[model samples]
Target: MTGRERHGTGARLRRMLAYAVLILFALVFLYPFVIQTATAFKTEPDAAAHPLSPIPDPVTTEAFAQVFGGTGFPLWVVNSLAVTLLITAGRVFLDSLAGYALARLPFRGRGAITAMVLAVMAVPGVVLLIPKFLVLNQLGLYDTYTALVLPLIVDAAGVFIMRQFFLSVPPSLEEAARMDGAGVFRTYWSVILPMARPALITLTILSFQSSWNEFPHTVVAVQDPALYTLPRGIANLVAGSLGAGTQYPLKLAAALLATIPVAIIFIVFQRYFVRGAAEGASKE
Candidate 1:
């Protein structure tokens, strides 16, 4: 073959190899979910019999009924929904406001404020558990919904993401608004925020997912079973009273329910998710 033909053949081989690797990785990541979903429909005995199977034998809804009817699953679902919605809305608004200020407003000590936000982002979440609990207790927010929802309302990472997104957007848009007698907040709300739909959706999805799946903070924030979120309730299911038997089907069903909202958001806003990821990488 000519040199050009030989190079083309080599490139084709590399591309095939890359596809093979990607397919293998996808299976590795996705097989467990397939198994979990299938096992949720299986009878307890059937699940045990075929741990890796993606097709359940004699599929049943006994586990789901037990979850929805017999357990605290419904309450947990309600609590999760409430907290997730509040936190998502709060974080989106606050993060965007703070991000806009950090990105656009040239006020005194802006650099220091940015630096503090960055520093806060760098703090490991686990490290704040004890301190957060203490503060919640002191503020009398312990065991309250306020405790669960308020502490997470303004995430540093969300602020940083919005700040980065705002930074990437041209200042010219805001400048034109300012020229039209719009103030900073008005410019941001009217002119800039509309353009930040992609970033906002990404943040909303992420915040919802994170808050929905949250476990540690929930443990620290509340002690009442009545206030238990899905993750906390599921942990109780796996490790507490309902944990007595090898209730794999029930456990998987609960997990599947918990995962549904995030899965829906991911599917619906996948493009924004990809763009946000790219934006994040570019910012870094």
Candidate 2:
């Protein structure tokens, strides 16, 4: 073969190999989800007998029916929705403002505050559980929705993400806004924030995912069964809330249903999420 033809043939083979590897990884990642889905529709006997099977021999909706009818899953959904929405909104707004200040605003203690944020990020969150519980208890906020939502309103990682993004923006934009008689907040709201859509979307996705699947914080925040979120409820279900024998189908159904909202949101905003993450990475 000619040199060019040989090179082209090698490139095609490499491309084919790359695709084969990616497809293999995709299947590996998706296999568990496939099992969860099929098991959700399987009879208890089928699920237990064929735990890893991707096909349900005799399909059923009994597990789904029981998830809603025989458990606190509905209340868990409501609580999770309320808490996750509030936390996501709060983080987006608060993190953006804090990031802008750290990036652009010249204020006393700004450097120190940024350092503190970094330090907090380095600290393990599990270590804060006791302090969180004590403060919530001391303030009489424990076991309430307020306890669940308030402490998580702001996160160091979100602030850091927003800061990195804001730093990447050209200062000339803010300068132009200021020359047009815009104050700091006005400049931020009208100019900076609009340009920060990518980072905002990234933060939104992370915040939503984190708060939606949160279990540790919930353990310290609330103990009331009436106030349990999906993760806590799922944990309870796994620990045998259904009582008697193992209800694999019911447990998998609850988990499957719980995973849907985050999956749908991620799929819908996937493009924006990717753009945001790319921008954030390129910034610093």
Candidate 3:
């Protein structure tokens, strides 16, 4: 074969190999979800018998019925939705604002503030629960909705993501807006924000997913069962509520439903997420 033909063949082989690796990873991540979905509609006996089965032998919605009809799952769903929405909205706005400030505003101690944020991110989140609890209690915000939603509003990672994203944006655009007599706030709101769709979507997805799946903070923030989010309620179901037997079906049903919101968000904003990651990488 000619050298050109040889190069073409190698490129094809590399492409195929890359596709194979991607497919392998897809299966690795997706298999558990597939099994869980099947188990959600399965009878308890059938689920127990075929724990790893992706196909339910006797398809049933009994698990779902038990989820909504018997347990506190509906209340948990409401709480999850409320918390996720508030946190997502708050984080999107506040984190982006902080990011914009850090990126564009020339303030005193900017480097120190940025360093602190990065340091906070580097520290494991689990270590901060005690301090969070003490501060909330001392402030009398403990066990309140404020406690539930307040601390989660300004995530360092989201701020970092937004900062990196904003840094990647061309400064010429903002300067042009300024030349048109726009002030800083006007420029950010009218010009910069509209151009930050990809990063916004990415942050929205992440904030939604994180708040929805937040069990640890829920544990420390509020002790009332009334305040339990889906993750917290589901943990109770698996650990304390489902008594006397291993009701795999009900647990799996709750998990399945819990995963649906994040799945939908991913499906809708996947491209934006990809673009955001690319921008973040390029910025780094």
- Top candidate, metric lDDT: 2
Per-residue accuracy of model 2 over 89-171 as CA lDDT, tens digit each? 99999999999999999999999999999999999999999999999999999999999999999999999999999998898
Task: Count clashes in each candidate, considering only residues at least 3 apart in sequence or on different chains.
Answer: 0, 0, 0
lDDT of 1 by residue, 183-269 (tens): 988999989999888889889989999999999999999999999999999998888566466899999999998898899989999
- Per-residue lDDT of model 3, residues 86-119, tens digit only: 9999999999999999999899999999999999
Kindly report the root-mean-square deviation of model 3 from the true structure over all alpha carbons.
1.9
Q: How far is candidate 2 from the true structure (C-alpha RMSD, Å)?
A: 1.3
Q: Which ten residues in a row have the lowest lDDT in candidate 3?
A: 237-246
List candidate 1 stretches off by more than 4 Å: none
As a whole number from 0 to 100, the lDDT of residue 228 in candidate 1 is 99
All candidates' TM-scores?
A: 0.96, 0.96, 0.93
lDDT of each: 0.92, 0.95, 0.91
Q: Can you list the residue pairs that collide in candidate 2?
A: none
Q: How close is candidate 3 to the true structure, as a TM-score?
A: 0.93
Off by over 4 Å in 3: 1-14
The superposed Cα distance between candidate 1 and the true structure at residue 115, in angstroms, equals: 1.9
Position 9, candidate 3: lDDT: 100
